[model samples]
Target chain A: MALSAFILIEVAGDHTKSAFKTIQRISGVKAVYTVSGSYDLIVQVETENLQTLSDLLLSKIRAVDGVTKTNTCLVLNV
Target chain B: MALSAFILIEVAGDHTKSAFKTIQRISGVKAVYTVSGSYDLIVQVETENLQTLSDLLLSKIRAVDGVTKTNTCLVLNV
Candidate 1:
């Protein structure tokens, strides 16, 4: 089954535009949008399973420059 | 321009399944999913502008039965 999450991102500097460009290219990221709120970006990501989701967050998302903190909310099937 | 948001919903009872069904049918709602976390559901909605988005949240989403609280994160353009 596919696993999806909304990864709320906080960027360190005034690099929202450049950061968004780089983030949109990540493999598992479906979409990324800058938002007018506490969070700088709203990222939609989907992976095959939880493990892949975890990897995507750690290896890809976190590694990106300008990203400071992340709050991941996993989508559950009910 | 299209305005989109991720509305985090909290349900009052064991009505997640029913809530999801009702929420999905609302106009402007792109998707609704039961999610694992503080929020019971992740509702994706898109409207023509911020006013329409506000109307959707008040007249449509908040009106749904079993939904207690909502935290809306407006999607911003970068």
Candidate 2:
């Protein structure tokens, strides 16, 4: 089954724009938006399974230069 | 300026679909999605400002049949 998740991200200093640009270009990232509040960005990602989701987070998203923190909210029903 | 926010919602019982359907039709609600997380659904809303956003949430969103709780995360940059 295809699984999806929304990742809430926090960046260091003022790298939100940079992080947004880089993240949007990444595969699996269906949508990315820069927002305020506690998180700098909210990203919607589509993946085949949990494994792929994990890899995308660890290897692609979290690996971004300005990304400081991340919280993953997996879509359960959809 | 137009302000947008993502509202995280929790609905009563199995009313997610019902709430989703109703919420999506509301004036200021740009998008609503059913998901599995700390909150059941995530809704994107756009309005003229915080006051209008508040009015939409209080009058339209909170009035939905199954909606029980809501948390708003305002978009800062975008």
Candidate 3:
């Protein structure tokens, strides 16, 4: 089963372009999109399980130079 | 002094209309806006402190009928 997640990321400054490039390179990321307000970026990712998803985020996405903080929401389903 | 927080909310289904109404009614909400992809909604709120913001989210916003999950990001100075 694929576990889907949405990640809300806060960047250091007006680094949307750089941050977007970094996030797109991360594995397990299904899609990345920009939003109008508040958070700088929103990303959709799919993984086998929650643990792997957590690991990927911690080790990869969060480690990007421009990203300051991240919040993850697991898609429960409709 | 005030603390600014960005809230990422996931709804049970496609209840954007109802959810927006419920969120706007909550106190301390600065602005709420819809995003283009991934997460359903993004809200900007200002509070006296972190605890008050947390309380508002838990006791009020999160308690709304259609809300499924929320993740908050405290804004740090740029």
Candidate 4:
């Protein structure tokens, strides 16, 4: 089964397309999209387990060049 | 001065209207709105400090009926 998570990220620069591309390449990431108002980007990621999800975010998503901050919400159910 | 926070809340029932009213009544809550996809409700709260904001959510907002889960996003700037 895949664990779903919604990641709300803040980027320092206007590299929306690049950020989306980078997040797509990360393991376990399912989808990414731009949101209006408050948050810059919303990413949907799926993983086999929570630990793997966290690891992928720490090592990959957070390490992306323009990403300034990230807040993750683990989806408990549909 | 004020600190802004975006709160993502999950409701067990279809009580979107009631949730918005209850959250708006909270001391530090600035605005509340419904968003599409993933999370059910998004609330914007402004407080004098982070601790006050946390307190408001824990004491008042979270205690409201119908709210199943809540995740807070603190806005650092803009």
Using lDDT, give the best candidate's number: 2
Note the DockQ of each predicted structure: 0.66, 0.55, 0.05, 0.05
What's the chain B TM-score of candidate 2? Answer: 0.93
Best by DockQ: 1
lDDT of 2 by residue, B1-78 (tens): 999899888899989988988898999888888887678888999999878998998998999999998877787764
Model 2 interface RMSD over true interface Cα atoms = 2.5
Every candidate's chain B TM-score: 0.94, 0.93, 0.89, 0.86
lDDT (10s digit) by residue, model 4, range A16-48? 668877887787877676654457776768888
Question: What is the Å distance of residue B21 in model 3 from its true position?
Answer: 0.8
Off by over 4 Å in 2: A76-78
Two-way DockQ contest, 2 vs 4, winner: 2
For model 1, what is the error of residue B69's alpha carbon versus the real structure, in angstroms, after optimal superposition? 1.9
Structure candidate 2, residue pairs in collision = A36-B76, A76-B36
Which structure among the candidates has the greatest TM-score?
Answer: 1
| A36-59: candidate 2 lDDT, tens digit per residue | 777789999999988999899999
Candidate 1 lDDT, A1-78, residue by residue in tens = 898898888898897788899999999999898886677888989999889998999999998889999988888767
Runs of candidate 3 exceeding 4 Å displacement: A1-78
Better of 1 and 3 by TM-score: 1
Q: Write the per-residue lDDT of candidate 3 for residues B1-78, one digit (tens) a residue.
A: 688777887777778768887898789998665544456777778999878987988998888888898877666542
Q: What DockQ class does candidate 3 belong to? A: incorrect
